[model samples]
Target: MEQDLWSVEFTSLADAIRSGRVTSTELTELMLARIAAFDGRLHSYIAVAPDLARAAARAADAEIAQGHWRGPLHGVPMAVKDVFYTKDIRTGFGSSIYDDFEAPYESTATARLRAAGAVMLGKLTATEGVYAGYHPSITEPVNPFGDEHWTGNSSSGSGVAVTSGLAYGTLGTDTGGSIRLPSACCGLTGIKPTWGRVSRHGVFPLAESLDHVGPMARSARDAAALLGAIAGADPDDPTAASVPVHDYLAQIDAGIAGVTIGIDRDFIAAKATPEVAASIETVIPILEQLGARFVPATFPETREILYGWHTECSVEAALAHRATFPGRRAEYGERLSALLDHGAQVTAFELAEAQRARRAFNGAVAAMFAPIDLFLVPALPVAGPTLAHMATLGPDPDGILAVGPFNAPFDICGYPTITVPCGANGAGIPIAFQLAGKPFSEALLCRAAHAWQGVTDWHRRRPEL
Candidate 1:
């Protein structure tokens, strides 16, 4: 059977539009139809903007017909995590409290995509306030691969939408592991850019200092396309770095020849499940065939840094929700309430000390990258857990702690990282490994990931659903 347009990468979809092989309206309608048919099982979308998407697609088609192609993403259909504020659209933040809240203006990330002529499919489901876990009151998105498997939190719907062909790509935030976790579990490529690489304006705050906005897509090149559209300094977000955005697609196909990929074999052997460890081990030879080399490297002791991450994130989250929590506290799920209550108790001095430790940890990790171009690690220590298993852990579970050992350190260190599907386990669940680079090294990361995808078909494998 011919693959659906929704399963193709955004780059391919854009090409089809420009070549007059398809209209943006046709593509948008196909995606909407897919959502109508299958999202019932995936539960990936919180809401579908049929009228808005159709209107936008018509506008895009008119522009392309007039030879006014905006760029690669022009007319491509995509969705965003519900945490992003979309003007006149219900920006639920995956919480019942804000379930009816619609933003007056668009988020910088979504606005940039819209400006690029991308058609919005709708808002994807997200954790409450894009925090540690799924919102208790909201319906959790099941993995497209299997309902028993985990979809990965916070950005769960974003992952499922991309993996199951509901959307070509979607935007997800990563304060800890939100982006990469879902990518790993759902078998997609996800980039968590260096801190401030993308604007956070109009995004619900999880942990302001640690928060990052990035893209999840079918391939590294697709992710690069999305990154190019959304990345850049935003005046509205004072924290958005003034760093010049690179043409991420420029070097994406450039093979990683002579590139030194650092691997901490001991770390993987000790921390990852045997299957995940073996899967990452398989990537070494494949990349070596593409002219890349590997060397031994060590990661900084993550225990202290992990603790500091919890402290800083909890305190910041508590402050972000202070006015609402304990005031209308019953409206929040028990786990989120507990987290807020815990954050309320963190002393001022403790927060100060955590910041100090965070800097030290960043410095230590930065030093590791000095001798290597990129460091590789498993995206998750184990295969994704089932929703039932996660349910037993309760709401407000320490998601960063539970899933972030391999993921959170980069957020703390503020380095760019990308997760690519390496392989799958016996049960058909996806397994992935991450590649971390120096700050603002998104181009290099994409290049390396693209090279791996070229040699392996892991990323191309989709769920039967």
Candidate 2:
């Protein structure tokens, strides 16, 4: 095995493993070794299932030797956010209260990946209850690009593991900006698939209605492959869309020629920081050069919906935790506790107003997408903020609340959005832009992102872990 094999993308790794040039055991062991060597500092995983991974790898190798090639994910090693239940594994939903809890069955998404022959590297870390901050007892994953920089939560572990070569790809759940924020912060390609496009059954939730299960990887094609393996309607999750799952890998090469990309320049300029604005401006021409046509578009008024996001998410989160919270509230972290406390105080009238606003926001977003196949926007207003700055977000909520303008609306509307590295800041931290489309339009978004990645080396760059 090549010494740098652990650093390869999911697509390449899959191809190699399927071709028998790289055995699953070899790849799995290599990843385990890397985690042992580096996770002390990175803390990208909540638990390391070495025995389970090795057993699965051996089984995959045996099956492949017998001519049973599963698919693109065969013999590939990957991990998922701790929120996704892994049968019999300590599925800590980033909360100490459930640190010893193990599910009898796995999440539909992770189960699908396992059936597709992907090895379980383990459960990656996430924020407490899959909300904004880590549990006081849980160590946060350090940004591989810069130690002091934030690795966007609550999928911080997903971003760090992939970018730092600990995992080729990982499943990330996004309610707000969990997936996209980490992808932007860590310079990776992440897809927050249309809500219901992927099943959430058996997965722990922070905000049930808003939560989305998706993949994060080093490239668009790799993300597409992961998405394909895990997507499709599941009986266990009635909410999982009954629509057909595209062969995203096959659709990824369709290219973006003649595709209409909507750009709300005034919206971006007003919402994004100078660094982010400049980086997004730079990505526009690159996409144009690839034959994507850009057109002027204006975003709908967002303040009402954005403000209401807190109320809705908090209420839902409070509900999701109703079984154990308050009764076991002592075990909960301060941030998550505060969220629940806030939710408990919300009046029935307030919740009704928030839901009504969400409906309006969803309709407005749908209308906005009618003229364009995709809407291009900044993934984050500020790129890779320091850990110290992120700490302040707790006290001065607006700093973090401002992020909803770029990311949360899509979650609110259940639109398919992909975030890809476009440029980097002076300190070499990455800046990314999101391409959001109508529901279940992941194929097109992947095509556009994959095309840009082919012409640009941003996705190929890795941190020196």
Highest lDDT among the candidates is held by which one? 2
The runs of at least 3 residues in candidate 2 whose Cα sits more than 4 Å from the true structure, single-residue gaps closed, are: 1-3, 394-399
TM-score, cand. 1 = 0.97
Instruction: List, residue by residue over 228-292, the lDDT tens digit for candidate 1.
Output: 99999999999999999999998788788998989988878777778778878888888889988
RMSD of candidate 1 to true structure, Å: 1.6
TM-score for all predictions? Answer: 0.97, 0.98
Clashing pairs in 1: none
lDDT of 2 by residue, 1-465 (tens): 455697778687666777788899998888999999999999999988999999999999999989899988888889999988878568989988886686988788888999999989898999999888789889989998999898898899999999988888999999889999999999999999999999999988888899999999999999999999889999999999999999899878888999999999899889888888888889889999999999998888888887788888888988999999889988888888888998998999999999999999888888888999999999988876787776665531355577657889888899999999998888889889999998899999999999999999998878987
Give the C-alpha lDDT of model 1: 0.87
RMSD of candidates 1 onward, in order: 1.6, 1.2
Question: What is the Cα-based lDDT of residue 407 in candidate 1?
Answer: 91
